[model samples]
Target: MTFQKISILFACLFALNTFSQFQVDADVRARFEYRHGFGNLFPDNTDPAAFVTQRTRLNVNYKLEKLTVLMSFQDVSTWGDTKQLAIGDNNNSFSMFQGWVQYAFAPTWAVKLGRQVISYDNQRIFGGLDWAMQGRFHDAALLKYKNKNFIADFGFAFSQESQRNENTDFLLQGAFTYKSMQYAYLKKTYNKGLVSFLFLNTGFQDFTDANNTIVDGVNYRQTTGTFFKFPINTINFEGNAYYQSGKATATKDLSAYNLALEAIYKPNNTVFGLGFEVLSGTDQNGSSKNKSFFPLYGTNHKFNGFMDYFYVGNHANNVGLNDLYAKAVFKTGEKSTLLTKVHYFAANNTLINNADTYLGTELDLVYSKNLLKDVSMNIGYSHMFASNSMSLIKSGRSNNNTNNWAWVQLIVKPTLFSNSK
Candidate 1:
């Protein structure tokens, strides 16, 4: 069915259930961003220019006793450009992001069907792709069960056809989590600290294009990870490690591993955080050539420095990174805070091994404040310094070696109704 028809149906459903044994909630967000760079350093190197983009999202959630339904739609477009295409259009006009339904058979058992986001275990093996302008969604079915700190999940997808691909491919995955300790950390004092184990398996079906050429065989991918959070004194410490095996676009078996550690200290209105991460690279003999790390469930903005050079997932393998990050936050007033972050990244592998290494450093500054009740604003700036071997230098490309960008954002949230227990 068309989006318009679906929207109308939802509106009717919501109106008809005003007094039923169900509850409904909605959230809306609008964002605008302006980005300009001084260099044409990457493969898509073009003329240096500036542009603004806007994003609007609507989220609707309905819960009836143990059953739930979720729907979200997002529109993205460049400002002041009638002829310009959407920011990241693989093909379609406004993307139909997520539409799903979930049903619970028992208090601890449930199943979900339809297009939705599949995020599990630190988001290394699976994630919602929230960084993109339109983000990413998958068509699949998921089953979940949780009881007394034990959780198990199973998921399967029959297709991976983005708007660009007319043919459909299949994928499947499964994961499990167990809570080992109760009240092991400050954040979980009421429930205890928990240990989690996760496993995922995915496969894609072989299909030919309209040209009748054999596309490829069904590729298999797998991931496993463990996570723990514990408190030391007034500080909280969290760490995770994961390993992944899969076939990349080249059909070559790829192997990768990642390790992350984070410490957060919170005292009254002040907060401080430190993090360290290491990613393994593929061996030279083409053995386990997929030396790329999976970020899993991290707040991408909080890691990889402020420049967002690494998390963009552009030159993944070429930009071997050993990153160290630190941040400090202070509440200036009742409704304002100042945050500063610094990142230092150096080449993990030999510079001579790959030419893409331009060891880099990034600095970020942000200030956030409440303008009024339910209204907030944020201002941020980032600066990146590229090393000699970095891709930012090309004669035909924009000559600016240093990259600088800034943005200002405003948000308004109004609640229709809320209940507290």
Candidate 2:
């Protein structure tokens, strides 16, 4: 074994000797995808991509009364991509997905530090992007308080590329992604219902010119929102509203908001749901400041459409969106289910160059089955009927062909070792 592996093994052994309890678990997921048009666009004359990707994770847990610790190692990649590495240069796909320690000194307060996942409400603002094989994690610290009916969490994070660079400019991966962030989340539970409030503040970095004569500029943005869900008899309803202010990452001015409402009826194995989301958009006029709202760090795939043509990395600094959709779910058996969804999308307003408002329609279908106690499988398909607007927005073509995609996935989770009492 390498030095790193040996060091980790020794550390694990030491922790086991000192900790009051320890446990271990593992997860493996493989997905085979046939992508004719998965994302917004594909190059011309390119055949559909068919490949298998896998993610494997091993987790260790330690607990001692008011203190708890967790560490997870993850590797995500396609098959046969990392075989027979060259000398001294190894495959670098493995990473620490989560490593955190939580300690509670008071009965109602606790603090957690290190890398972790932050998800709230319906994961509209901050989410763990589980759809992606690598998933998502944040290196930060969090303080949480909870009781029977109330819970609250406060988190802060800052990112830097290196320690000895002596650089003043913040290194941002993208313009829209945050370089620094903080948030406050509060939740209250009522009989048969619950409500959550969130406030998130983010900042983006802008470096000066090459000569370093100018000060690096920074843009700050704030998002405040509330989410509520309640059940009335046999029907369940939820609503969300969020507003954004302050300068955008790339623009000098920003003012935006988004609102949504949804209802679900599930009296039996069959279920039905309907929802609508409205996001403010910028006007086509040059004088109008940008009014488009963005759900930063959200699970966009869960909304809009699975094809990710709307908010999954595109559509920023552009026209906003409106998504109206319906879904039906039928449980075939105790271990099998089928789900179908339909969506109609439109631009909140015309584009800057005066394009049409109707974007397109999409259909999605999925089937899931539990093969064994620790294994599950899923198959999904999606088709997008692009309109003149969608084609113009995604591709330059105003008259493009239909887009289709398919995928099959299998998940396996197991506990390798557990000797805690």
Best by lDDT: 2
What local lDDT does model 1 show for residue 279? 72
Residue-by-residue lDDT tens digits, candidate 2, 307-328: 8887788787667889999999
lDDT of 1 by residue, 290-311 (tens): 6665453333544676556664
Clashing pairs in 2: none
Ten residues in a row with the worst lDDT in model 2?
82-91
Q: All candidates' TM-scores?
A: 0.77, 0.93
* Candidate 2 Cα lDDT to native: 0.83
Off by over 4 Å in 2: 1-3, 6-10, 85-91, 165-168, 209-215, 284-287
> Scored by CA lDDT, what does every candidate get?
0.60, 0.83
The top-ranked prediction according to TM-score is: 2
| Predictions: Cα RMSD each | 6.8, 2.4
Off by over 4 Å in 1: 1-32, 38-48, 83-95, 121-125, 128-133, 160-192, 204-213, 249-251, 283-288, 296-301, 353-358, 392-400, 416-421
